[model samples]
Target: MAGNQEPLSPRARLAVTAGRAAAAVSRAAGRGSGSVIGGKVALRLDPDLLAQLANHLDVVLVSATNGKTTTTRLIAEALRANGGVVSNALGANMPAGITSALAGGSDARYGVIEVDEKYLDTVARDVTPKAIALLNLSRDQLDRAAETRMLAERWREALSGTKAVVIANADDPLVVWAASSAPNVVWVAAGQEWKDDAWSCPACGGVMQRPGDDWFCGECGFRRPVPSWALSGDEVLDPHGSAWPIKLQLPGRANKANATTSAAVAAAFGVPPQTALERMHSVTAVAGRYDVVGYRGREVRLLLAKNPAGWLETFSLIDAPPAPVILSVNARSADGTDTSWLWDVDYSRLAGHPICVIGDRKLDLAVRLEVAGVDFQVCESAAEAVTACPPGRIEAIANYTAFQDLRRVVGN
Candidate 1:
């Protein structure tokens, strides 16, 4: 009994030492958000420890089916633009990662965290952000769950206790429904034409028809009200397409949706609408998510395809399949893990190819592309896939991962 007790005390002491060592190393490496830990990062922490860590954060929760990361980045930028210090390290949105991010910095007025769809409830319960931005909720990561309806349910639960002012996407039916309970919700709607993909109402099972790009319940006539800030346009112009424009740097309609949503949220925080728009124009792209770069003397664009709607939006952005597109799919326990959702993507939206396929799940993507009658060459690895394409011809590669396999290959 004495020997066992001796070991337990020593083991507990060692754990404390290890925790301190980790914190020291994290600080030395300039990591922040020491408070807001993510479940995906530290899966088995006891509730008390988790609560201790979270108590230090002034978290700003950001969730959406499509554009959380992009929108989160934009919000961070807007906050900075308006002379407020913000805590946001790219791609670190979970509780542990967000904690680490906050730890990296010491004096930020706000913490802008992009919350994972599944973990939204946990983070919301823990972080208790000053403000929550609910971007559009579309069908994403279908392999993780059966349907978007379930995600909507989880979101409703996550947002229930957030006394923070809510900025929601007025364009999405599912989001509008989920956030209906928030009294302080500021509805942000984009222009009518931008609401191209509104799904039907989950409550009444009614056909949700686009009444001039604004949504209306076709069967029940329940109107989805317009947003406070809306962007109306026929063609999304990336002025940077011709020249490196000093004002606005991003391209495509999906980007416009992201920029507009960012503008609205910034305005809600009292950043003037024009100031928000001006700041938005300064963003070129978010990394690994429709991020564009010059690689090997050719333009390389990365678009993350985790779900069907993301795929559709990516398809909508590119102009008729830029030459030598590379699509890599990897299976990770963190990122849905199953490739069956590949079937649901509108791969037919992309026509023609010198398309190269790569990843642990490359064969799955290859099979899907073949069945869909698209021409593609399967590569053994991501680097080889990039190598296979001649410089300048291979313009972009859209790779999926829960790990850095693709990033290591593309070197971006």
Candidate 2:
């Protein structure tokens, strides 16, 4: 209440107050994990609450099928140089979360909000963010988001004729197609690890061939755009051919890619590359995505992979065949009720590997592992699975709800 950043009109103030009260009650009653319920109540009380508060803030919007939460946290941390900032780092990325973020006060000059892929068009219209980052788009929540291509088209239409600066990943063909028509844009080859989704060219709908970092469409002549920043092997290279070393505690090339794009956006807002990277290095985790937790007197490292793309990228970071990690999954609303997407993932990669299968969908995972000829055990509890695993830094990979369940049980 003290850090009310945006001076409000009487009507907006009433809505913010109502929303804050709802959030407090939810937290007190242990019914809601965040301000989502409160945000919804506020929106209903005042339909234009988002636009009313956003009018006074210079904002940056981050959209991605994956990594939106982590990338948003990175940008917000780097912008600490600018003073106070408000962001939805807790995974409340829909309209409700965005509204709740703005409703909470702060004179913070810049607001970095994570906009869900499905709601990018809706939130962008209200915030009119000064800068927007379109990270990679891949199939996720097919039940809710429809298709990846449809989401990209919506993004293109939403930003049409807008004055905001757009930063896009040139490595993802769909991302390139989505951001192509923006009035102003900066492209970054932020190192996409998943290639199966981008094999088909978005332009001609023809098969694409990747000879190296660039993909070419033989039919339509659409090729990878030359990027202003290139993320290669632990370093991001600028247009001047100078390499900025990437040093991070979070393992994986995907994180390096996240850092690369965040630094690029920070520079667009006048923050130096070195300074941005420095701030980002301090980020150890984002809402438990890659967090280490102490559970039952042992360390449990959590990794979340919602869909095929995320699973593919995460697997590339750590050895699977020999590492002996626990795999948890559940068919909850958070992780689309449909478990059909599991087939799209390459489970054969785990053939001959040892793994522990848990979560509500343990039967499904065990069956899949059976087909792949992988050696695995079935467990009902994450605690029991950890005990069965070999000692020292046991890894636990899960879908959305299973990951949250771990967070709650592990006391995060």
Candidate 3:
């Protein structure tokens, strides 16, 4: 592998020799075999190795507390529609995960990646994406990422000298504020329509004034203007029932933001706006994210709610009458060690409705439900919970781990 040269495929004949050598090194060093996703091994190799993998390709990095995966997929789809192939292995964001994607040379000229917030600085440092999309920053996995403000500062530092074209959401005060320092930044707001008024000024903690749905700091005088690109006009319709006719295939307000950011990124990459819209409109679905399924002659909707912000977005998407709703919580420290964040969620939204509780921490969710004044039942296991509920139209909300458990229960 030399300068700007694509690396050999991981499945190539030489891959066996490389795998054996890697296995020997791991064994001699007393390490476990690496984990795999999309049939590629994710390992922490030397940083210098990144130079050898996909040197000829331009990396497009998308980062956000929410919507990163959906947006990355959306942008990749547009690129593909315009005759550009893309390599985005399963929702992998870590540096090692990226290395794995490049292990198999992509047929496309561009590489679209959904990067995790904590790993953004590291990936940006090594990959130096040709373009970067910054989505809204909301409260999330405090145990893992600390404060959003801190993460913003670190991203700023990582992106300092990079020549990547930046496409950012103007609605998020944190994202807009960070974009102020970028070299070549293009602000993409959901327009005045989807602009949220309830936001605090990042600089002085002053009350942000809302001229309609748009927000600006009264004291500090920092205003977030509407972006040039948007999906809906000034009044964003809250799609309550089935998914709307938006350009994005995914449902929910958060996804609207994802569509907006992804479209802007595609345009920045020189994809025409009309072409971008056509490609985006062609998008259908992404895994574990608003992923709809059929099980035992019944429809099942699977959504991933990892943090409070993510939960809030997911909660608002369920509009129909509460029909046998099953809520699963994971107690394990790894899935979410403390599980204390449940208190922060607006469970009151489930108001006076029946909800079945299951998984490792059924009591935890039950107690929260009790506080919220919602009716509920508890089952020893997810299997019993699903079987206990009357089979008809069912709405299930489960955390990351509990989601997997429920999937097994439904025989998926």
Candidate 4:
């Protein structure tokens, strides 16, 4: 609802108005996915709402285990160089949010969509985006139903003949394998910080071994594909080895990779490196991610780590030990029903650090921290924990639902 550049006809405007009305009613009733429900209502009335709305719009669909929201945000921001971009920054990847996002904008020239991993194939088949950026893949932890390898296979099969160009992280073998399925792909040498899930060759089911930075499968001779764009150190390097300095408002190498990923996709869409870098560096946060908030006279920098892989990636960004950290967990519907993934994370990395455990699954985290010999105290909420921390920028990490809960608590 933030950007709308085109004017709609009387009938189309009425449909969008009806959808907005539904969204207002849903929000007034305190319902989740108001945008989704609103979009659904609009779709019910006009079955081809998204197709008609985004008929001439250049669409970029993004999917991965993590970094979908932030990556989508970066791409959208960069694409603004051309014209308005209709995007869903609400962590919504399904029909409802995608519909609202595509239909809400009347004049935007592009749509940057962050799709849910499970729904990627379905969404791609329907929308036929201009570019599909695959960040990386790992176990989502709570959903034991779908496997990562199978998802890649499905992606390959689904995109076999699609017109969209695929921009993928070559460091992630699963991503490479999946993106390779598409007829056209622009491989990116974006490093994969986490490689545990991709130990097996997605092509031949052979064992994959890393010899230095390159991966090769022994049994089937499958190997890494050459990348057109590569992230080396703090620079995004092209195939000719020309480097573009990556200056981001976000922290961590993971984020640098994300910015580079966005740059690569945007460049493929014809945005200049200088312009793309400027737009991407302007983003300090995406939704609630990496937001620094003031609550009860303490500064709490919020971070989200939903699974073991996410925790492993996030820990690299937090200040080292003894700095007093707040760790919150939850097992609600959005946070996954299983809290067992806590055991999978290497909280031992913060072995000597002081951590204030909070949330519905704080006890579970406490037990895991205790087993790792971490110093911790239980608090009623993340707000309380941050308030009790030392007088400095306090680091607070949480799962999906708990992250949202912490924001509400801190806001009040």
The number of the candidate with the highest TM-score is 2
RMSD of each: 8.1, 2.4, 5.7, 2.7
**Model 2 TM-score on a 0 to 1 scale:** 0.95
Per-residue lDDT of model 3, residues 1-412, tens digit only: 1134455455443443453455456656655333122123223323354444546667788888777878888888767655554555456566655665665554557778888887888777777678899987766655665577777777777777778888887777778776667798877755322223236777677888877657789998988855665556312222121122346566776777677677677767677555665677665666565656666555667667766777777777887565667788886653656777788788887765457788788888889888988888898875566666666666678877787667666646
Which sections of candidate 2 miss by over 4 Å?
1-6, 320-322, 351-353
Model 2 score (lDDT):
0.83
lDDT, residue 231, candidate 1: 50
Better of 2 and 3 by lDDT: 2
True lDDT of residue 291, candidate 1: 58
TM-score, candidate number 4: 0.94
Worst 10 residues of 3 by lDDT: 234-243
Expressed as tens digits, the lDDT of each residue in 1-412 for candidate 2 is 1223456778878988998898999999988654899899889988899987777677899999888888899998888876677788787989998999877635666788999899999999998898999889988876776687788889889888878889899989888988987998899989777776788888778999898777889999888888998798888887678888886777888888888888888887778778888888888988887788876666778899989889887777666555668889898888988887788888777665467899999998788778767788999888778788766666788999998887787655
385, model 1: CA deviation in Å?
2.4
Return model 1's CA RMSD, one decimal.
Answer: 8.1
Off by over 4 Å in 3: 1-45, 191-199, 233-245, 331-334
Q: State TM-scores per candidate.
A: 0.79, 0.95, 0.83, 0.94
